[model samples]
Target chain A: MSAGTGDSVSLAAAGPILFDLVAVIVREQGRLSEIDGQTGDGDHGVNMGKGFRMAGERLRAQGEFTLPQGLATLGDTLLSDIGGSMGPLYGTFFTDMAEALDDTDRIDAPHFAAMLKAGLAAVQGLGDAKPGDKTLVDVLVPARDAFDAAQREGKSFADSLAVMKAAAEAGLEATRDLVAKVGRASRLGERSRGTLDAGAASCTMILSALADGLVQRLHA
Target chain B: MNRIINDPEQVADDAIRGVLLAYPDILAATDHPRVLRAAKRRGEGKVGIVTGGGSGHEPAFLGFVGAGLCDAVACGEIFASPTAKSFHEAFKAADFGAGVACLYGNYAGDNMNVKMAVKLAAKDGLEVRTVVANDDVASAPRAERDKRRGVAGEIMMWKAAGACSDEGGDLGQVIAVAQKAIDNTGSVGIGLSACTIPAAGKPNFTIAPGMMEVGIGHHGEPGIAVMPVETARGMAGLMMDRILEDQTFASGDDVAVLVSGLGATPVMELYILYSHVDAILRERGITPRHRFVGNYFTSLEMMGASVSVTRLDGELDRLLAHPAHSLGLTVLGR
Candidate 1:
C-alpha cells in the first residue's frame, strides 16, 4: 500500500503517518532556524516549525485531510501563521500542490510528480527566483529531476524516492558554491557567494530528511 | 531541521499567553474575539487611537500600544489581517467615546477587513475614522503611493496620527489630519537578513552574507536593487536615495523623521545609522522637526531598517505634541 508512484495510499492509513511526518518536519524547521540565527535571522527555524505545527494541528483536529485540502491548509497556514515573506512563497507551493490534487483521495507516482512540479512552479511564480539563486529550489529542482529520471528507468516509487534524496543531498552540497540572489542575504552580494544560503541549506536538508524518513518508515 | 513544538495549532494561543505573562503593562484582550490589547486603561479622556495587523509584526501591533503611541491594537495571526469582526470587537473594548481612530499600513486584506470594521462601528453609531500608512515608496511613486503597499511606515503614521486622535479632535477631523500625515510621508527599506516563518521552519528567502535587497518591505519582498552589503553609512545612503527619489520634500522642509530598526537591529546600530542619515539630511539642508530611532517596527527578528520622513506643517507639529496614555506613550499623558 505504501508503494511507488501511482500506488494509492489510503487517507486513513497515510493520514496519521503524514501528520506525524509533518510534526517531524516542523521540528526540522526549528533546528534550521536555530542554525540560521547564528549568521542569518534567527526566525527561520521557528517560522518553518510554526508553519508545520499549524498544519499538524489542523490535521490532528480533523483526521485525514485530502491531499489538496491538507496542502491548501498548509499553504494558508504558512501565509497567515508564519510571519515574514517566506510564508507566502512556501505556502504557495503547498497550496498549488493541493490544488493540483483537488478531489483526489490518493496520489500515484505520476500525480505526486505533477504535484511536486506544481509546487516548484508555484514558488517560482511567487518569488521570481530560480534554483541557482541559492534558494530551496537548488535542492528541490534536482530532487524532482532525479525522481523523474528514476521513474523513466522503471524504478519503483521507493527507488525514485531514493533518487530524489540523493539528488537533494548533492544539491544541498552544491549550494555551498552558489550565491544568494534573492531576499536580504542576497544584499551581501559577493560576500554571500561562498556560503550556502541558510534557507537553501535548510530546505535541502528537509528534502534529505523527508526522503530518509519516508524510506525508513516504508521499510519498517 | 528539528526543534520542539507542542500542538501546532496552539502556538499562537500559547504565544499570546507568553506575551501577556512577559509584559504585564500590556493586557491581551484574550477575552475578545479579536486579539485586541493595550496598556492598562488609564481612564483618560484622550481620544483613542488603535492600530493592528497580522501577528508577525509582533511588538509592532502589541509592543507599541503603551507609553509613547497607541491606546489599543487588535492582532490577527501572523501575516493574516484581523477580520472585520475582530476589529469591531476591538473597538468595543478600546473606544473611550471621545473618539476612536484606527491606523495601519495599506494592505488589501487589512483594508478590506478594517473597512468592514469601520462600517460596522458607524452603523452602531460609534464615531470611527481611519488612516492608512502607505510608506513604501519602493512600491510606488507619490502620486500612486496611496495605492502601494504599506510596510513598516505605519509606526510613524501611528505615532503622529495617534497623537492627533489622542487629543480632543473630532473623529473626522482627526482622521483627516492622520490622512494628511500619511500623505506627507515617504519611506523605503533595505534587508540585510532574511527572517523565517515559524510554521515553515526554513528561510522564506536568503541573502548571501554581505549582500542586501534595497527598497524591500518587511515581508521579505523583492526590492529595487540587490547590491553588495555595504557599510552602515552606505546602506543608509541607499535607502534614503530611493525615498528621496520616490517623494518630494525640498531642502529646508521641516520634517519628522523616523529611523526604524526592523527587528533584529539593535539600538546601537540604529544610532550609528542615524548619524549617517542625519549627515545626509543635513547635507541636503532638510530641517528636522522631530527625530526618533528604535525598533518600533519589526518583522519577527529580521535584520533590516526602514526610513520614514513625514513632511510637517505647523498643524502636524502641534498635533504631534499632543497627549496619550498608552503603556508605550506614557510621557504624553492625557
Candidate 2:
C-alpha cells in the first residue's frame, strides 16, 4: 500500500472509501443524536446511522464498485430509506456529488473540488439555509471554500485536504455561537445558541472522513 | 422507557405493522412499506389526496387515510419527515388519473422531501401540488406567519382538501381550498411535560412540574414562554387568547374547533379543557359549527393539549360537513 502509483486515488476503490465514511457515521451516531436532542427531535443519529448502515451492507455485498456508483448507492439509500430533513439534504448532496464525478476514473484536487462544490450547491439549494444559519451549511461552505482556496494557491492535494478538514472543524465549532435562523431549531430563538448544531457536527465528521480517506489513498 | 414495543429502534416500523393488522379494511399497503393507501378506492379522475410526516403521531399522517381523507400516506421515523422515495410512492398510490394534492405541515424535512417527491412524480408524468399548513400561530409572529410550524390544525387542512377532492374539485381548486383552510386557521399548544423519543432513550427537553410551555411544538421544540401551570379554565383562556389574537373571528362567525391531547394527556382532561374553550367561544359570539375533542394528533407521550380554530364560510362549512371516514376522524353526512 506504499505510495508509488500516482498523485490520485483510483475511482475503482470508491467502495472501500465510502465504507470508511459510513463507519465514521456509525461510530458517531450517539454523539450526533445527543447534539440534535438539544434543539431537534433527536432522531438524526438513528436515522443517519440506519441509512448509512443499509448502504454499508449493500456495499459489502457488492464487493467492488466505482466511486460514482458507491456515492449513488449511498445517496439513493439515504434519500429512499431515511425519512427526515437529513434524508433529502444529505441525499441530494451525495447524489449530486456522484453525478459530478460520474465517468471520472481518478480523483485529483480539481475533480474533488468540483464534487465538493456540486454537493454544496445541491444541499444549499435544497435546504435553503445560508452560511450562518447554524445548519450543516455552516461547515460545508467554509470547508469547500478552504479547499478551493488551497487548490487555487497551488497546494498539493493532500495539503489542500488537510486545510479543508481544519476549516470544517472550525466551522463546526462556530455553530455553537450562532443562532439558528431556519429549520426546527429556529423556533428556539436564542436558546438555539451555545449548542453545536447537529447537522454541522455531522457534516464536519463527514468532511473530515472524506479528506482523510482521500489523503490516505493519494500516491506519489 | 416503559413502552409496549419490541426494539426501540423499530418502533415506527412495528407500529406501522400493527396499524395494518388492525385496520386492513380501511387502509391498503403500498409498494413501499413506508407508504400506505386507502382501501376503498374512489372513482377514476378524482384528484388524489396525500399527506405524510414523521411517525409516533398515531392515526395521524396514516390514520387519516380513508375514503374522504388522505388517499395515501408516507410515514417517516418518529418526529421525522418521510423520505422523498416514500412520498413519491405515496403520491403514486393515491393518484388515479387527476393530479395529486399533497397536504402536509410546514417542517423543513417534510418540505424538502415533498419537493423532491414532486420532482420524482413529474418524471412519471404525474402532477403534484402542495399546501403547507402553518396554523400554529404561536410558532411565529403574524408578520412571519409563513414561518410558523404546522400543528394540530393540519387535520383541518386535510379534512378540507380531502372533502374538496371527493367533491370533484380540480387540483387547483383543492390546493386553493387547503391553502385557505390553513390561512384562516390558528393553533396554540401548552406542554405540561416532556416526551421521550423511544430511540433517544430519554426526554430531549423537560417542562418543570409546576410550569408549562406555551406554544410547544409537536416534537418538543421550545415554546414561546414557560409559566406556571394554570387551571384548566385559565389554560383554555390563554390558548384562546393566542389563537384569537392571531386570527380574527368576527361575532356570529362559524368556526370549527379541535382540541387534541398530546399523547400522555387523558381524554377526560381534554374534555375538561374543551368545556372552557366552548364557553369562551360562546362568550365571543362565535358559533363552533363543528367540534372535535380527542387525540387527533399527538407527540408521543407528551402531556399537553393544543387548541385549533378554523373559521368557515359556506364552502368550508359544507366541506367540513362532508361525510368522511378515517381511523382518526369521521363526519356524518347532512
Candidate 3:
C-alpha cells in the first residue's frame, strides 16, 4: 500500500484517549461478562470498566495531559486499583508503553511501533502467556505485528493503526476455538474451548478504541 | 440478588470497613486501605506469616489476620486477587526485620499479584518467600498436581505455617513446614448451587436442581462429575474417596479434619457431613486428632461443603496444637 497522506497525531490531543476506552468498556460491560461467564467468573468487564472509568476521571481532573501521561495514569490506576491477573498484566502493558513514548510529543509510525513493542515486552515479563494461550497476548501480539508490518510497508500512520485494530479483532475472534492455557479458564481444560477469552475481548476493545481515537486526530 | 451490601461495586471496601469495626482487637488498618495487619504485633526476630485472596470468602483472607496466624492480609475484590500494590503493602506490614512467608492459594490472579509483590518487596530490601497451597485433588491429575487449585485445605497450610513462625522458626523453616502441610493435605468440594458475585448480578455457574457437582472449585468452576444429589452419608463417602485416592492415610496415621461449609451451607449440614466423614475415617483406622467444622473458607454464598484432611506427623501435630487466635479458627492450648 502506498503511503496515504504523510500525517501524524499530536500526543497532546490524545489526552482524552482513555475516555474513549472507558466508554467502550462501559458499553461492552455486559457483553464481556457474558463471554467470561462461559468459562470464567464473569467479572472481566466489571473490573475493566471500573479501572478505565477511574483513569478517565483522573485524566479529567488533571485538565491537560499528553498521550503518554494519560496512559501512565491508566496503568497506575489498574495496577493499584484493580486486582486479578489482568491487573498486573495490563498495568505493565500500558506503563511500559507510556515509558516508551515519554519523550515523544508527536507520535509517528516508528514511535507507535516502539510503544507497542515495549508494552508487549512488559506484559510478557509479567506473565508466562504466549499466543494461543487464549490470553490478552493473543490480541496484542498479532495487533503489534500488524501495525509494524503496515509501518514497514510505508503505510500512513492512520492506515497502520487501522490495520492493528482489524488484526486485534480477528485475533479476538480466533480465541473462541482455542483452549485456554493460562488464567482461571485453563482449569477447564477442553471445556475452555468454544468461548472467547475475557482478556482477549477486552484487549481488542481497548486497542480498537485507542486506534480510532488516534486516527481521528491524525493531521496531514 | 438479596445481599446485605451497600454497593455492588464497593463490596470489598464496605466489607473491609465492617471487618475493621467488628474485629478492632484483632486487625489494624495499614496505609493501604486494602491491607490489614494483626492488631497484636509480633516482635522482632519472628518470621512473619502473610496470606490473602478475594473478599467474598469472609472470615478468610482478612479474618485470619491476628496473633499466631497471618500477620497481614491483602484483600481483593470478590473472587479476585488483590492488587500488586496491596500485596506489597501487606508484605511491608508483616515485615518485622526478619523475612516474611506469604502462604496463599494457587490461583492465577494470586500467583501473578504475589509475583509482582515479591518483585516490589525486593526493591525495598525486604525478603518475602511463598508457599502456594494446591490441595484440591480433583482439579488435576496426580502427575499435574501443581496445576490444581487450592481449596479449603489452605487453612491447614496457614495453621501449620503460622504456628511454625510463632515458634521462632526462620523464614525458610516456615515455608518448608507450610509446603509440607499442603503436600500432606487433600481436599475436595461438592457444590449444590452456585453463588453470585454481587457485581456480576448473577451466578457465574449453575448446578441443576437435585444435582450436585463433585470436585467443584472454590469459584464455582465445573467439577469432574455432576450427578444427582446424594444423601449426606453418600456424599461423605464420595468426597473421602477422592481425598484418600490422592493422599494415602495409613491405618495407624493421625489426621486433622476440616469440614467447611461453602458460605450458604448450614452449619448443621456440615456437622452431618462431618459425622459421616468421621465414620469413614474410623473404618479406615485413621484417627482424627483434631476436627474443625464451620464456614472456614467459602465462596460468596455457594451451597456446598469441602472436606480437608491433613496427615499429621510429630512436627505437624505440635504445630497444629499451637495457640492461635483468629476470627476464623482459634486453638487455645499450650
Off by over 4 Å in 1: A1-220, B1-11, B26-30, B40-47, B119-123, B323-334
Most DockQ-accurate candidate: 2
Query: For model 2, how does the per-residue alpha-carbon lDDT over B222-317 read when each residue is reduced to its tens digit?
Result: 888899999999999999999988798888999999999999999999999999999999999999999999999999999999999999999999
lDDT of 1 by residue, A1-220 (tens): 4532234443333334446547666657656755454434455666677668777888778765654666677777765555344565676677787777665655556766887899888777656468798777888799899999998999877678788888887887787687666654554445566565566666665556545544544443
* Sort order, TM-score high to low: 2, 3, 1
Best first by lDDT, ranked: 2, 3, 1
Error of 2 at A207 (Å): 1.2
lDDT accuracy of residue B257 in candidate 3: 99
Report the TM-score for the A-chain of model 2: 0.96
Per-model lDDT: 0.68, 0.91, 0.90
lDDT tens digits, residue span A18-103, model 3: 78887898889889989999989999889988988888788889888888988899899999999998888889889999999977
User: How far off is each candidate at the interface, as Cα RMSD in Å?
Assistant: 7.8, 0.8, 0.8
For all candidates, state DockQ relative to the true structure.
0.05, 0.88, 0.83
lDDT of 1 by residue, B1-334 (tens): 2334466435555666777777775565556544556656624565677777867666577766764466667776555566556677767666776667888877644765576578778898777677788778886556765556676666656766666654556667767877888778788888889766555556657778988888876767667788888899998898788777766868888887888777787879989988888888888988776777877677766788888887889888776666544433333422
Model 2 lDDT per residue over A85-156, tens place: 899999989999999887678888888999999999999999889989999999999999999999889998
- Report the Cα lDDT for residue B167, model 1: 55
